[model samples]
Target: MKDVYLFSGFLGSGKTSMLTDVIRQLKEKNLKPAVIMNELGKLPFDSQAVEKDIPLKEMLEGCICCSGAEKTEAQIQSLLLDSDFDVLIIETTGAAHPVEALDAVYSPLFADKLNVKGIVTVADSKLWLHRETLTPQVRSLFMEQIRHAHLLLANKTDLLTEVEQGQVVYELQGLNPHAFILQTTNGRVPLHLLEGLKATTQADKADIVKAPIASLQLGSRLVEFTDVEFSQEQFEDWVRTLPETIYRMKGYVPIEGIKNPMLFQYAYGMVQWLPEYIKMPAKLVIIGENVGSLPVIGMN
Candidate 1:
């Protein structure tokens, strides 16, 4: 039987980074793993960051939980029938609800052949600790992701003091008492922590009550730029000035003074820039509530 792993996390919680490490470790163990990447934007960004050698299928322009349900089921069926991989990882968009994603995975087609190895949720320690500060709908979405997790990877623990880390874990335990919580820095979790985990069963699914998405007022805008370099400081200032509703934004940008083009990401009010060596057009997809009227250049 194939092992199916579903990774659920809020945006900027480092799901991709942890997934990269997980894939590398699985490769080291001679295990073939296929990945399904779900994105909310029409244009792809995270899919490009994944290693080329890995077998991948992307579900873009919608979340797997709702609009992309049919595609999610079809992709898994295709992978199951065509790929030789022994494991499948569905990396859902941060906006996804774990229960809905799992429901799609457990579609009648692959019931006997695949086992839900685990539903792993990676959470940002700081954000989760202060979830009350978030808008009601956004907070509901975030909590739903954590509600059904079998393993909670409390990532970005480096930003917390010892007492703070314990406090975070303690609070999460209150919400999910049975979940195994692991502290991680930069999502560097050990191989054993993720592999050989128990599969999520029907009873597990029944226990997780589905939350309504009516409250989530998410909107996305794709901004394209010509092959031009931006002033690094100016870009940073612009990113910082973005409204709080703009929760997540990521894409490639070329900074004027920087030696290399950079991959920029903004999540939880923090903007991060990583130098990119590749030659690609500058563009970004910004996701948030009430973001439709932002003064983004060349928006589509």
Candidate 2:
């Protein structure tokens, strides 16, 4: 049976960084690793992080838990048949709930062929501290991710003070006393600790499968800026005007005076822009509650 690991975390919580580290370690140990990456938009951004040689299946335009359940099962079957990998790592969309995602993976069609090792959740230290800023549904989703983790990583500890780190650990431990909590920087953790880790008991699995799948009430919009250029100041102003319900936005954008499109990312209230040497499609995927109805100019 192939070992399967599910990577769960909120947007910009460093799931990709942790996934890359895990892939590197697996390769060093001479294990072939495959990935199933789920994205909320038609265009995939994070799938690019997977190396060319790794067998990858991309699930786009919906979350695997609800809208893409059958597709997920089919993809898993395809990967098992077509790939020679010993390990399968599923990196779920940041907006996904852990229980729902797990249920989707436990489909009978492919469940017997695989062994689910565990769910590794990367929780952003700062985000936990400021979770009150999130909408009620999102905050509950974040807590559920931590509550169901077998190995909980308090990542981005470098951004927190000693006191803040303690608070994060204390709160996370309260939520999930059974999980092995590790304070990590840049999602770094020893791969040896992941061996034989199991997140859910059989009883827990039964409950998860039977539990009603809660709708996150989240929506997404793809904003294309094919030939548009925005001044840095103008973009910042627009970002500032965004409502609190708008949780995550990421993609490439054309910036004034830049030779190539810049990689833009926004989570919670933070905004980051990184220079990209190569030109990419200038489209941003905005994810949040009622994102499609958001009254924003130029985004439509």
Candidate 3:
């Protein structure tokens, strides 16, 4: 059976970064894993930043709830039938509903073969209080994400002080008392967070999980590291010539003597690049505002 790790979070809450870290750790331990990612538009960004050893299936053109349900199911089911991997990590769209994504995973023909070890909800601790009224659509989406989470990760803890972070966790815990509250800065977290958890599908209404309407956010600090080889000359040149609104940039670079390319990521001002110890070289993903270039990979 495949142990599935379902990841959900609001925009910029660091779900993508967290997923990449988790995969990196798995690869470091020599474990095989599969990944499925969803995005609202036609492109997939997170799917590109990760190491290439993992098989990635992208469900695009819709959020997980409506537009891409059946296709998502088919892709996951096929991954199960074909791959003998250690785990399945799924990153849902920033605007997605985690329960809906979980529902799709547990749909009729697939549940017996899969086990849901954990539900991770990454939230921006700083934004949860001040930006409570951001948007109705986003508000609803995040509510669903937090409500279904078994591990409420209050991400971006560095944005707040030690006490403020605790307060935030307290508030969130009150909302989802059953969930284990974990405070984080950028999504760097312990691997045990995903181990040995039990989940009953929504179809099993009596065992369903839901948090209160109250607000809270928590998560781990983001860790960026890489050993990918490349010319600092070209990378710096690319940055110097980059557009103004390039929010995040991550991909691979072919090293001078290495057979496999290196993995790299850039967010805000920080950049990270790592060598693929277990995976291969694949597509490059860059996300930005008014950032108009398409990723090299056409998977989405």
State each candidate's clash count: 1, 0, 19
- lDDT for 298 in candidate 2 is 50
Candidate 1, which ten residues in sequence have the lowest lDDT sum? 201-210
Model 2 C-alpha RMSD to native:
16.1
How far residue 18's Cα lies from its native spot in candidate 1, in Å, is 0.9
lDDT of 2 by residue, 210-271 (tens): 32212223334455564468987888899899999776666677888999878887767999
The total of clashing pairs for model 3 equals: 19
lDDT of 3: 0.65
Write model 3 residue lDDT over 187-274, tens digit each, in one string.
9777776764553321221221232212212211111114434475566556656555454544455655766666765655677778
Q: lDDT: which candidate is best?
A: 2
TM-score (all chains, Cα) for each model: 0.66, 0.67, 0.65
Runs in model 2 lying further than 4 Å from the true structure: 199-300
Clashing pairs in 1: 230-256
- Cα deviation at 279, candidate 2, in Å, is 51
TM-score of 2: 0.67
Q: What's the best-to-worst order under lDDT?
A: 2, 1, 3
Model 3 earns a TM-score of: 0.65
- Model 1 clashes, total count: 1
